[model samples]
Target: MSGPVDPARIRDAIAQFGRTLGPDVLASCRALFGAQQEALSCAVPAAARDLAYGPHERHRLDLYGAAGEAPKPVLLFVHGGAFVGGDKGDPSDPARWHNGAVGRMAARRGWIGAVMNYRLAPDHPWPAGAQDVGAAVDFLRAHAADHGGDPDRIVIMGTSAGAAHVGGFLRLRPDHADLVRGAILLSGLYGITPLEPKDEEYYGAADSACDKSPLEALASTPLPMMMACAQYDPARFQAEYLGLLQKRLTRHGALPCSMSLPGHNHYTIAMHLGTSDRRLEDSIAEFCDRLFA
Candidate 1:
């Protein structure tokens, strides 16, 4: 007998549910996001701690770990905030997001979890965010041994706008491929055209801007990637973009593994990362293992 049903239909259903949540959900969540993050931190292992990178007034990274002598693979996480608002600190707000499921789960799995902050849009924008991530990756690789992390086994993971940052890093810094073994792009934006007409002034055009769409960048080199999104995420356009990427990769004989999580909303899909669900995290771990194998 056949197992279950068509994957496309399942994805469509999840998209429908996410749409039903309306735009207000994002707005409300943004309001109380900090508190949620604080509550979430309680789940982190006691050994987990935060660290700063670069010189004074430079970027900082929050590190998490489970107690043990064995070195663990590093998972570098970047949070989503539409390119404008977000921080690695501020546990009082869920919006701050220092201690989410990803952090907690990384600790539980005995992995070195590194979450860092990047420059925001309008002020920094495009290449700035990507550059920060690249710098952080390099910093981690250079110092991973001191922190009980395997520099060569680093994984770049991000959500929404953060995903865009990851994509940009992969495209712009191929020389650092040795540092980034793979990427997990979750609900990321690819093209600037998708921005509302009023928002165009923020990102400018794909032709002139240094932060052109990742899709355009991929024409040159495609990195090993696993892109996924929640079934209920309102950003269905992101899924469409992923489909385009799949086709592009296939045409080049380099398509990366991809998936759309079932019964998960945009927020919840990421939340499930550090949970026992194993649907997303397991796939990520499997990919990492394969990369090393």
Candidate 2:
């Protein structure tokens, strides 16, 4: 929808991902998205196309993996758009990009990467996203091995709203808890309040929103967890990050593995996967590898 992004701005954006927060946290996402779209134009292709995970048309995933006879770990990724908008970008599109890049990141690491599409808010909402994540897990457990994925090492990862969904999975789908080997929450809104109307639209009344927030509901989870926020993430995301960390440490007596990417913002925390800025990428890959080991 936009023209080419400035290369310098992209570099500056990546530089900002792992730094301290500043005045420009909310101002840089659009530029970063433009830059990401350009960068994704050159990404490797998905090995599998739209494979349904659930009954909804959007309940689908794309797989990317290298040729391997052995079962590999899996990264089931969810995208963020304030819980309302975003997609598993068409790999065919040279102009727009999405979470598929993260899938490619998984495949490149000798894992099976899956980028998913969940029904959005105001139409399909809070529990819907959570439900979709559970369904994706079921689908993966049922078929990951057929696609060369080790069902035992499946990890759920998300950014922003998607991160909320990932965290919600631990809380919402307790029956499927054993299916998840680890979890990653990147720039997610856990229990940060003053629900924006749009967020309320997905989460329902304020009470419902509070009740559903993983930040408020999750004190301790058995799954290996990690939460990361970019240096330039929005104030609310940073707030939620600190709040979640404090809550977990107070309740569980230990903090989950966490990081603050110095040169990135909320968007780049996940966007930089498979890019030259490998700080967050390396951290996540290490986490997944260690979990499987």
After superposition on all CA atoms, what RMSD does each candidate show versus the true structure? 6.3, 4.0
Per-residue lDDT of candidate 1, residues 1-293 (tens digit) = 02333435434445554555434655443333333334447767434344556553437776777536867788888887677766654444444453245665676667887887887767765677788889889888888778788888888888877887887887678685667777887877766335653224335664465457676654345457777876667655455546656665766776667777777666555644653357887887777677644
lDDT of each: 0.65, 0.78
Candidate 2 off by > 4 Å: 1-43
lDDT of 2 at 278: 72
Count clashes in each candidate, considering only residues at least 3 apart in sequence or on different chains: 13, 11
Off by over 4 Å in 1: 1-17, 20-24, 27-40, 46-50, 55-58, 89-99, 197-202, 205-207, 219-222
Among all candidates shown, the one with the greatest lDDT: 2
